[model samples]
Target: MNRTNSSKSIRLLNYIEEKGNKLPHPVTIFILFTFIVIVLSHILYVMGTSVTFEGVNNETMETEMLTVEAVSLLVPEGIAYMFSNVVSNFTSFVALGPVLVAMLGVGVAEKSGYISALMTNTVTKAPKRFVTPIVVLMGVLSNVAASVGYVVLVPLGAIIFLGFNRHPLAGLSAAFAGVAGGYSANLVLGTNDPLLSGISTEAAKILDAGYVVNPTDNWFYMFASTFLIVILGTLITDKLIEPKLGKFVPTEPMGNQNNEVSAIEKKGLFWANISILLTILAIAILVVPENGPLRGEGGSIITSPFMSSIIFLMMVIFLIPGVVYGVVTKTVKNDKDIANLMTSSLETMAGFIVLIFFAAQFVALFNYTNLGTIIAVKGADLLQAIQLDGVLLLVALIIITTIINIFIAADSAKWAIMAPVFVPMFMQMGIAPEVTQVAYRIGDASTNIVSPLMPFFPLVVAFAQRYGKQNGVGTVISLMLPYSIMFLVCWTIFFVIWYLLGIPVGPGTNLNY
Candidate 1:
């Protein structure tokens, strides 16, 4: 918590950041990787590289030994196929459509100021003694709408702390810890759930053709983790981070820094809550009955129309509340305002769309080569030979993902590369893809606050400097390091225990395949 403990680590992280900065952009990295796969495919093909594994013949429902050979994309037929499938590959990308649709609803909520009002109400109204927990909890929930916490709640945390006569850095760290460190934990499903699950489903199909990984596959564990993160974040902030910074003495009292919610905003927030309740009630009516239309055969919600339509449901959930809030506050006067707000939200996604275009090609080409299956079978054989199955295997993956996350900040890009290899490999070891996906998420989130390569890291540094000129990247990282370490350690342990207990990770997902 002290400067001495973290000062040296900050220097090392800065050096790591420098090296990471020197690397190509994420899009370039994927493009270069695509070329690497192409080259490797040819060489391996020429060298007669292949793996014989016991796999199910999905059509026949029989277990058979299959020889998966390296397919060369450098060949004439390969080139022709690539040219023909390029557009389809991008368009049919599993993660693309669902994420965009979810974002459309999230866009309305954010643009209508509903998300902002909710966060302000949650933080500013908390009792001082309970402020740390409340801020951290709000940060965890803010992920429901995507990146809203970073822009709104983080600075709000600092301002709330300053108003309470506490060190602003401590408050900022707490919020950052929850927003980034608990990135994958949420009571309500976010855009990331479907985005990741879609990718995971594709990866699983490589091994089992009929396998389907739902967006809610990791919901149970993630819901439990929300509370775990709040408790841990609060303790680290109040006990370690805040005390280390000592007391704050404001040179100039921030007079005009208003933290109170205006009367109109409060009214908008009240109606927004009502709207959310009505939406949920409507959905429940369609989903809860024994013979409900949304229910699947045998009244199963997991395999029902409701489950498959989660993205649409999510869109409606946020969109309705957002529109209602905007109407009450006069932010949305008519249909034109709503349409314009949705367009603006899509504007923020232009960069993500570009990234997904390249990433999709990379994944599609990798699958086309059959390299993913070969790698998975070979890796599984090695791990099984070394007796690294079960909990240790999951633990090792979490650590590896944590380290990789520091250098590669984009979660989707990292998962795109990793899932093809790891998901099927673990499936071969009798571990489910849902478990593998959750492991990746935990590792990805734990180091987010400390990773300088994260897009929001510098923005958070700016938030810190607003309170004290001396506050920089090091100051922010130092303040956050304890929370990161504790989250990584405790969360991994919690997952291990959860795994050992044979708890179902989500509605229909067991730890084993």
Candidate 2:
């Protein structure tokens, strides 16, 4: 009976995967969406579609009646606007520059062996009983370097478990949970923070033109979530997954695989740590002093240069430690090596750049047509009429995002499409864009483990195959499903409690705008 149910579940997931892959590429979808929006704007304009709401005049600071009407792009003026703004739209995309700048520094750390060494040093040195939590914790932290966790820690987890004579699959599951499932939770800011926040900020401008969603808006919640994930992942592995997987017997000879940190690498890590402390100290000096340059008017830190320069500061934080580690280990011999590493990092962003081109056009046109505002106003009205405000509203967003995530796996792409509508709509219902953004992240991170369409899902399956020839994608999914479900359930509850308690999600951020 159990075998039959498992077979049915696998078949269903396989069907979903098959259909999802058949969908057009995200870039192509955006292009189609842009065309559709153009045609829809014309139709809606002819149909007299518009919405009236009270809005504040930014320049005059006065309350006034605002009517948003659909504007068609088929006219000569519309066509001219589209052609003239194409380059500017892509260049001015809020999510593009910060992510690219941050990635350059991340590339340095990842390429210079700093991130890998740090992950290895932490995981390999832990005691037997504590290794699982340490592995999970490293997985959660490894995301600050972006996608490095997927390639490095996922497989390293299996080796660690095998070394301890435990079920290697369990270790793989635990690590996979942390890397993919805990993706949104990190102790430090990464490329994703700026990317998602930028999108949310643009979305917020549909209603509040001057509103700015900081990259650190969700930092407080995500920082705490890191521990929640570590704890939940650790328990699921030891209590449920390891016991269910039973015992593993190696069929082949285990060869020597050096997983230990070398003496020189340790020395390099020491200097890297010192560099990080120095960086933090330098930043503190600029922000902590009453007359500091980074301090805002009246000694306010929130509205200061330090807050505005977070993206650049994040880059420097990673850049300095990476360079220090590289020089200490001779991995970076000179400025030329550093330049090459930065170039290598940017090369990985080629696909993202292409996607952003079409995405920018779609977002720019969507806003220009006033379709987003119209939709948001009407949608907010509907949600409020149905009493889906406050906690219920957030929970609904989480569930909706979770389902959509199975088909569309890119976080930025999904958020770009959803934010323009949901962020403004939620804001209308007295919810902050920051709260909406975090809810979307919970949904996005939860089902990543079970989503076959996720880019790394196939890679995880391949890793599992190393343990047993019979292991396949189903095995990996089944192993991780527990973690995914638990993360979704417990993480959502944690967020709800945080919201009810009226705790700020980040520095100076509130649940209500």
Candidate 3:
């Protein structure tokens, strides 16, 4: 029986890998999706199908009923939109800017040998037992630093594992799972907290005029989830994902591999630390005053200009340390060397740049057709009439949310569309809005690893290709499947058990209002 079970497990994984690999290239997939969106848009428009829901109006900043009708791309106006918006879409796509800019800094760090030296030192000097857990922990905590996980930590993970003489793809999978799959679960409150909570509050207001949801309302559950993700990511990497990757032999140079830090490298690390400190000090000076340039109106951190420019800040954070390290190690002798390093880094993004162009169009096309919003509205409507109660109802909500998330990649947007319907419906049934929001979060985060529509999905693919040039969408997805399944199952169970015991989901937030 034991052998049979093991065989079945191997078969299941192989099947997943086979199916995933069978799919076309990530860029081709995006192009195909865009084509499908166009056809579906025409069909739905011909049928005169549409869905309207209450959404927070961006211009008015108030809850208003919003209607989305399918648009036929065959129509003149639709064609015009497609043509006119293509450039804008590619230029303004959310993921494109952050990923490219962040990579600019990381590229500098990588090419300058700072990242390699750091990882090598960490591998040799740090205790082996703690390395995997530490990597997972960093990935989880990266949420607080915004999109750092996608552009920075994921690749660094591969490098770190490579330094340890382990399979680099396995490390990449672990970090991606924690960073992307476990995105919604964190030990502390961050920008997303307010974004989702604000939407939940607006939805709750449809039932109660003065309902308010704070950012930290999900802190306790999320704190627990942080540890859960770390443990799960570590285990999945060590026990499952790594074993599947087997042995990897690196094809590229990974800097000085003496396995011992040279005196110059040690000096470089010291200067890098100083550079990081100086960067932080400069940022603090910019944001600490009431009238500072980085402070938002009324001095709110969440709304601050500093928060808005986090990507740029991250670039500085990485670039300074990298240049200092390079100079100290004599790898960078002049300004031309730094410029050449950054240029070399950009060259590596040729494949990624091509991929993002199509991805941008696909995401724009989906939104243009309004299919994502319509589907989410219809899905929420279906769940509302199911008449579930108590823990079962929450489970249903999570499942539905997860399904919707596979299509609608934007967290706040999905919640905005669904919240008006479900939040009010749940409140009418004696459930709290906070509880509903928490459930939606679980579904939202768990599937990020598998969703091709996610803005950063292509970027992760690019990261993976740096190590295993042949690795594709299938490889990354197969690696992350366990983490997704395990996190969703375990997180939902934790929520259900906590609910049964009448535990507060957050501060003064109960299962029911």
Candidate 4:
């Protein structure tokens, strides 16, 4: 029965990969997207296409009609902006800095042998039966640390599974699914939450001038989904993914020691934990009190320096532990060794650096020409005109967002353009801005693994190459597609049930205006 099931599953996945391989390279796709944007902008501009939505006055809190027009990329001013902003656009791109900075710290941990030792410790301590679920859970939680999981955990998952005489690809698929497929679900809020919320608030202003969507707007729902993803991810891996892979066969020699904790390594890990605790204590001192230096304006914790500096703090957190481990283990013979480790990590990002140049141009062009905005507004207008309301409308939005996510994977960029359309349109149906935001999150995150355009998709492919030298984009997508579909279906169901119960999506967040 297992072999028969595995054969059928393999055939289906093989078909998926074959179909996916027909698609262009991601870098080429983004480059082609720029041309499409340019042409579409010119055509729309000539047609004088525009949409009118209610806009709120920032000062007076009054609503008025705001006409959104598509500008021509071929226009003189547009040409000037495009040419002049090329360098700055790539340099200032949101994704470039976070991934690069985070990797530097991760590189130190990875290169100094800290990450390997930690992984060994974690695997040895964890019960074998709970490994899949725990890996999925960690992947879900990794959203809080930016791209750390994509760079670290996915590969780690494979190694962990291999140690237990299981097929490593199953572990890779599960981790990727939990990391990318469950990207929106996390116990602690991530950078994406603030970015999406800010856009939602801006869009909500069209309906209620003073309306605000906090970063924690979707916290309740997201927190719940974190567990849902772990469970679903685990079930899919153990039931479907693992069964299909059949057995473990190491294509590469395993270097990890099982349950063998060296005294030096144990001591290094202990002091690393101490450094982390001390840092946390110091941060708490600065942020916990009424007059804390990290507090926001009027003593707000959310908008404070501590919240704003999370990514930097993550880097610091990793750096301290990594350096401590390296020093104690003699992995870092000198300061130059630390520098070399960081550089080596950066070296692995060569393709990403190249890919970003194209992505930056495409994003900049899309923003300047306002094509994404027009499409979003048009979609919302159609739905509003049809009078699609309540649960049905929300479900439709999820499907629409999922389809769009295939070609566009930048969460913030998609939401920024989408919010101005969907938020106000949904508001017309008496749906709250926060609710619309949550629907978007469900769709956007669930489809990430299948999207070739997702930034980390290539990195995942590279990681897989270490295990199977010939594994390509198709293989990764095939392995991850089931999780993507399952997450979307299950998560959307949970969302609907939660909404029907009139549950608050977050603290003081509502489903209705």
TM value for model 4: 0.76
lDDT of 2 at 29: 85
TM-score ranking of the models: 1, 2, 4, 3
* Candidates' C-alpha lDDT: 0.90, 0.90, 0.74, 0.78
What lDDT is reached at residue 350 by model 4?
79
User: What tens digits encode model 4's per-residue C-alpha lDDT throughout 287-316?
Assistant: 999889988889887667876665666667
The C-alpha RMSD of each candidate to the native structure, in angstroms, is 1.4, 1.6, 7.9, 5.0
lDDT of the structure predicted as candidate 1: 0.90
Give stretches of model 4 more than 4 Å off: 1-13, 57-62, 141-180, 188-220, 236-261, 390-394, 400-441, 444-485, 498-513
* Candidate 1 lDDT for residue 388: 87
Candidate 2 residue pairs in backbone clash: none
Of 1 and 3, the candidate ahead on lDDT is: 1
Sliding window of 10 residues with minimal summed lDDT for model 2: 1-10
Q: Which stretches of candidate 2 lie over 4 Å from their true place?
A: 1-5
lDDT (Cα, tens digit) per residue for candidate 2, span 1-513 = 012226776778778888999988889889999999999988998898999987655676676888788888987878888999999999999999999999988899899999999999989889999999998988888878878999999999998998898888888999999999999999988788999999999899888888999999999999999999999999999998898878887667657746898998999999998999999999999989999999999999899998999999999999999999999999999999999999998998898899988999999999989889999889888987888759999999999999999998989889989998999888878899999999999999999999988988989989888887777877887788789899999999999999999999999998996
